[model samples]
Target: MNKIQQQKSENISFNYFSLLSLMFVKKYNIQINQKNEKNILSFYS
Candidate 1:
């Protein structure tokens, strides 16, 4: 393959990876929030 085409594919893959990471972070944040709430309640009790 030509260099330009190879570079284009690499860029596309990088973008896809970034999108996946963003989604994962969002899901992680939700779980963290719920866990934090439970922990706070237990500590207070």
Candidate 2:
């Protein structure tokens, strides 16, 4: 019973970590895309 409870907690924490990492990755991707767009615009200008 105790082990099951511990496993549940671990699973919850793992899920939270994955969610945080996913958000971070999405933000990083957006920033990279914006930078690329800016570079392209500057090159054309």
* lDDT (C-alpha, whole model) for all candidates: 0.90, 0.92
* TM-score for each candidate, following the candidate numbering: 0.62, 0.71
Report clash pairs, candidate 2. Answer: none
Measured on C-alpha atoms, candidate 2 has an lDDT of 0.92
lDDT of 1 by residue, 1-45 (tens): 699999999999999999999999989977887879987678779
Give the alpha carbon lDDT tens digit for every residue of 1-45 in model 2.
999999999999999999999999999977887879987678779
Clashes of each: 0, 0
Which 10 successive residues of model 1 have the least lDDT summed?
Answer: 35-44
TM-score, cand. 2? 0.71
Deviating ranges (above 4 Å) for candidate 2: 37-45
What is the model-wide C-alpha lDDT for candidate 1?
0.90
Q: Model 1, 29: alpha-carbon shift in Å?
A: 0.9
